[model samples]
Target: MESALLLAPKLVSNPSREFRSNVRQFQSSFCGKSIAIVEFTRTDAYTNHKSISKITSLFSLGKKKVKTIKRETVIPDPDYRIPIVLLGFAGGLVYGDNLLAAAPVGLLGLLLLFQTTRVKFVFDDEALEVKVGEELDESGENVFVGGKNRWKYSSFVNWELWWPNFPILVYFKETQTKPEGQIHFFPVIFNGKQLYDVMVERAGPSKTSGPN
Candidate 1:
């Protein structure tokens, strides 16, 4: 009876040991699967991130950057000589008892003087443009019926600065304004030296020689 009791206890202990071993095996397998799933998720995320970065880099490389050319002021300072001379002439006319002539001359002088304060000449790499005010804003449409305030240097057929020693007037003909070519005349109300220099440089040498 004692031996039988001992044998029964051993049988019960063996089954309990087997069940514990099985539970340990199942836990180890589940833990390994969980680790593998976590590793795969991280690797996939890393791969996707790398791919996105490469695509972004390729797009950046493909896009071309545009170059912007800056416009420069050719006539930085204004010349009031033309307007002052006109006004002086008008005053002389008035003194000479020529009221009829004086009225028009005085009006013209006033207009020119006002223009001298507002008008500006600006030059870009390709063209010459007229601007207004200290801020260099567009001068709007030309006073002439069919004319623009801008002209390309390439389109200039010829240009001249009259009385170079004491520049009073500037004249230029350009095909851009008219295919047949258009003649333009403007008073020298800007820095004559700078104007002549820029014109020679951009539009090529004028037919007439400038100041020595």
Candidate 2:
């Protein structure tokens, strides 16, 4: 369904240059869906005309339900994360005319400084780690990773990825109401209950108790 939507512009005789415009038009309504859960289900060809009609956004939680999920949002030295990204995602500045090529790197350096630094969060089959800056050397880092929670180790508990520049700011404390409660403000990925259910299927007996 998503592939068809992306290909629709070409079918409409629109040039590749106009693809962004087409996507922007489709993103209009869905862009405002704050705290909405997006899922891919069967595409409704008829009701789905607005370029992006197939994907669904579920704003199903009540105010109180949503309120229970609050937590602090912070990242330590967020600038460190920037350098790594600038090395990877640049498009124009490096290839523009000679005059622009000579452009002072100060601006780019500052921009990347903001990108590469932040509180890090990683959840894999083994452990869930958190810390300030990238702990490339996991041997002697500060509380870089919070030990195993009652939560299981399932990859099915996928997280939402954000365009870090305009990150989806998730303000929730670790354990929020759980014992290991700690405040945070940084770019991290998260998957809610339904995802946890999927994780439980794979992680086996990892569930502990939460204050809910």
The TM-score obtained by model 1 is: 0.62
Q: Distance from true position, residue 116, model 1, in Å?
A: 0.2
Give lDDT: candidate 1, residue 121: 85
* Backbone steric clashes in candidate 2, count: 23
**Model 1: lDDT to the true structure:** 0.74
Error of 2 at 210 (Å): 19
Q: Give lDDT: candidate 1, residue 145.
A: 35
Q: What lDDT does each candidate get?
A: 0.74, 0.37
Name the top TM-score candidate: 1
- Residue by residue across 1-212, what tens digits does model 2's lDDT show? 99999988665663322212211212235534434333323333455433322333444332443334422332222333434444333434556543454344435645545544533444344434453345432423334344432222322122222332444332323442245554333332222332233323333433223212
Backbone clash numbers for all candidates listed: 0, 23
Q: How do the residues 133-173 of candidate 1 rate in per-residue lDDT, one tens digit apiece?
A: 98989877788836669999999988999878888888888
Off by over 4 Å in 2: 1-120, 131-135, 139-165, 176-180, 188-212
Q: Pick the candidate with the highest lDDT.
A: 1
